[model samples]
Target: MNKLTTLNDHYALYVDGSCLENRDVSATTPAAWSLVIVTGDNGLGKGSGEILEETWGSVITDSSDSAFIGAEVGSNNTAELTAIAEALRWLLIDGGNRPAIVHTDSQYAGNLATGNWKAKANKQLVAMVQKLWREVGALRELNWSHVRAHRGHRWNERADHLANRCVNNQAPMPLSFWKPGQR
Candidate 1:
């Protein structure tokens, strides 16, 4: 019966879910990348009471391009994080920029993004995200933030939809969503 409506609520969800990354985020760089992750059960409603509940999860990643890129129905946190990180990588390299912000619906993934925390629950996915983060850093801007699910935020909602597509294996491949004429 919880409905997310504000950034504070999203932050609260991350804190309450043991989902927030537990790492040291004191490093500073001259890049600006904003990542907003949206994770939660698929088919979840906004406290409508009549909506059915589903146990599916998804995540979205976007940069300044305004294009939607993400995945859905992750088998676990690792899978979801990997999907999101990969999407960011493609976007950054193709977008031709430095220092990028990465958004995710997963606190676990967020932790890995900033190195404020390490991936313990899902080692493989964590490794994947770590690799992608490094690659993105080598290319352009990289920022990390966690967005609460079903919060109704424009980017977050889009991410949620994209993530759902990913979880369902319905998302377009990274290359498919890539913008043309950008190496």
Candidate 2:
């Protein structure tokens, strides 16, 4: 298990994914991914820390079909993987050199990205995320932590909400500027 390096300035990114009709997903299914980046570590509770950034969007598929353009050909796994990729991409480009930890509820994603489990499906997406993980490691410390879903974990629940909102075509909440403990 890769442990997070102790750092006061490290960032915590809570990510989640949502898919509409997951069991019946097809080439036109809707799925979305979201991430909430924060600082501080009062544990992973509601007031865990102050929100530094929040982002959510449709999950783009590897397919080139126009009908399946944005989030159409997506599944829960794809959304989960994409959320991780986007979070790492953000850290690589805009996160300075600060160490960061990504918290996710998907054990599948966590295991695959950290080499704890071999991927049997979605090889391409898995490869992309693994590559990005390596790239981010080259610059600063990056680690993954498994967070249980829907257990009232603040940022994790927020990420779930944002992803669901995106899947429903609703506007995302402005959590980036939201102070801790504010409803």
Candidate 3:
């Protein structure tokens, strides 16, 4: 497998989105995004490497409170896309040049950000994510990979937990407070 296919020898960022009521999502829907950055060799594996940072927040509108007023609506896909965008933004600020890889369980997010699929909805959000992807790529080596969700992947699971915590209006857990395989 190519380097992109493998999780070793690179900084890995695992991101996830959570929406408790995804069927009929709206501006008031309980949705959030979270990302976990890992460092060291074989960082993707369970109980290995260090949890460098864990960040999460609720999905809210840009300005207007009304979803009908061109404000962002909270949904699973939007949360997922937002997670990727926020991850890229984090990298731009602190990622340095360490060949980084972003792992997500949402193929919709991975494909759309990588331009492998066209976005029929959420055009504004998708465009923003694509722009961040390009800007990050211009600075360093960046790659995006899709992982199966809720399949016992360590960092992915942690990201899911964090996102859900935000959806439930809980505070983010500190980086030093969590270790690999804690949950």
Cα lDDT tens digits, model 1, 1-183, are 233343222211111111123243111111111222333322232221121111123232222324223222123353445445555555554565533344456676677655779655545446655776777666654555565655653444444443344334454234235332211
Q: What's the residue-level lDDT of 5 in candidate 1? A: 41
User: Model 2: number of clashes?
Assistant: 0
TM-scores, each model vs. reference: 0.47, 0.85, 0.85
What TM-score does structure 3 among the candidates reach? 0.85
Tell me how far the alpha carbon of residue 27 in candidate 2 is from the true structure, in angstroms, after superposition: 2.8
lDDT of 3 by residue, 1-183 (tens): 136534455678899998887887776777889988987636444647777888888766555533221226788898998899889989999857767888999999999988889999888888888988999988888888887887777788789889987888877565568653333
Candidate 3: segments with Cα more than 4 A from true spot = 1-9, 41-44, 64-71, 172-183
71-98 in candidate 2: lDDT tens per residue? 3357898899889988988898785888
lDDT of 2 at 138: 85
Q: Which ten residues in a row have the lowest lDDT in candidate 1?
A: 11-20
